[model samples]
Target: MSSRQNILTGSPWEDKVGYCRAVRIGNLIEVAGTVAIVDGETVKADDAYAQTKNIIERIGKVLEDAGASLSDVVRTRMFTTDINRFDEIGRAHGEFFKDIKPVTAIYEISRLVSPDYLIEIEFTAVVGEL
Candidate 1:
């Protein structure tokens, strides 16, 4: 069996859900769907762009803990409630992975865990041995 390691992001969900922000098994690190909520509050509700940025930031922390970086990410999934916010969300997502350009998929879902949440993102990265 492959050894596993957990990655944390200092979010209350880490305690409440009894799960880590990310987990590393072998060369793969899978991150959970991270929302824009920080300190129990949504960072940007009106601005989909800002919300996307905030969500990615949380996911970034998980990648860091797994000894991976955004550049190492091979795939990503974004969940949004409104389809109209594609441009806004896409812009924000592009800001970070501009150079690396990970394969990404976005979906306009009915709702999220909370109404205030505008976006949630999950990532998968391949970790290389040092």
Candidate 2:
């Protein structure tokens, strides 16, 4: 039987919404949609690049807790309020995952949980033999 684990970031929303930041089932880890939220406040507000960077960093932490790394990430999905800012968002993503080169998709969304948020990202990772 496969074991399961839940990783939490202590976000109030996790409790209110009854969802964890990420879940690990055996070798696979699935991270929830993440934004540039720190200390219950949005960081980088309307900047897509900065927000993307922050969200990736946040996902990295959750992955670490789940016994995986960014290199283990096999896919990523990015949701942005403005597709025109793809250049900035893509640049930020490249800075982090350029080497790992995970499959990715960027979509223009009407909005996020917060209007101030410009980007949200979700990830999937498969842990390899250590």
Candidate 3:
């Protein structure tokens, strides 16, 4: 059996919300929805594109902690405040995933845990050959 492993980042919300950053079992890794917050402050507060990029970078580090790489990502789900920012969001996503080309979905949401957050993303990755 594949024992479960929780990839934790020590974000305060993790404890308050009772969830880890990601969970891995066997070869599968599921990353929780991530936003562009560092040191408790939102990154690129008003720029959707920059915020998306920051979120992806944060997700990248978490994925590595889960023993996976961006190339290993098979799918991604993104949620955003405004559909009008799709172009900015998509552009930032393309930069990280252009060659990897993971399956993706983007949805317009009313808001996030914090109003400062413009976007949130989740990832699914498979580690190693099947």
Candidate 4:
């Protein structure tokens, strides 16, 4: 049978982007790269730390919706506009995954879909007996 699928929260972008918050394929759950946007715009400008925290929290919702927690996460990918902000983003990333110690990669990008976004993160989790 096909794996169950669901959206974690009711974000306007879910329909606009045509993607779910998290999709479960068999035992794997793939989460979309989440930013700190609350409505249609970024909430805190230049606050990469807070933005990172917000993004991770939003991702938490997606993981929870799929019957998984952050501990289930096995991998993560982070995208940032400025490499210099790695300290801020890395600390935030570490705060969440410190216990799980999931494989992670951070990249510096020219820009994100939105200019205000400083950091974006996506996670891959294996639920149930991983």
Write down the TM-score for model 4.
0.89
User: Which segments of candidate 3 are over 4 A away from where they belong?
Assistant: 38-42
Worst 10 residues of 2 by lDDT: 37-46
Better of 1 and 2 by lDDT: 2
Question: Model 4: per-residue lDDT, tens digit, 1-130?
Answer: 7657875577787888787778887789999888886443445778788899898887887788888889999999999999899999889888988889999999999999888899888899998763
lDDT of candidates 1 onward, in order: 0.83, 0.89, 0.90, 0.85
The true-versus-predicted C-alpha distance at residue 52 of model 1, in Å, is 0.7
TM-score of each candidate?
0.87, 0.93, 0.93, 0.89
- Model 1 over residues 88-111: C-alpha lDDT tens digits? 999988899888898999998999
Q: Residues 1-130, candidate 2, lDDT per residue (tens digit)?
A: 6889999999899999999999998898999998886333445576788888888987888888998889999999999999999999999999999999999999999998878788889999999842
| Candidate 3 or 2, higher lDDT | 3
Q: What value does the lDDT take at residue 83 in candidate 2?
A: 98
| Per-residue lDDT of 90 in model 1 | 92
Better of 1 and 4 by lDDT: 4
- Cα misplacement distance, residue 39 of candidate 1 (Å): 7.4
Best by lDDT: 3
Model 4 clashing-pair count? 0
Give the number of colliding residue pairs in candidate 1.
Answer: 0
Predictions: Cα RMSD each: 2.6, 2.4, 2.0, 2.5
User: Which stretches in model 4 have alpha-carbon errors above 4 Å?
Assistant: 38-43
* Clashes per candidate (backbone, < 3 Å): 0, 0, 0, 0
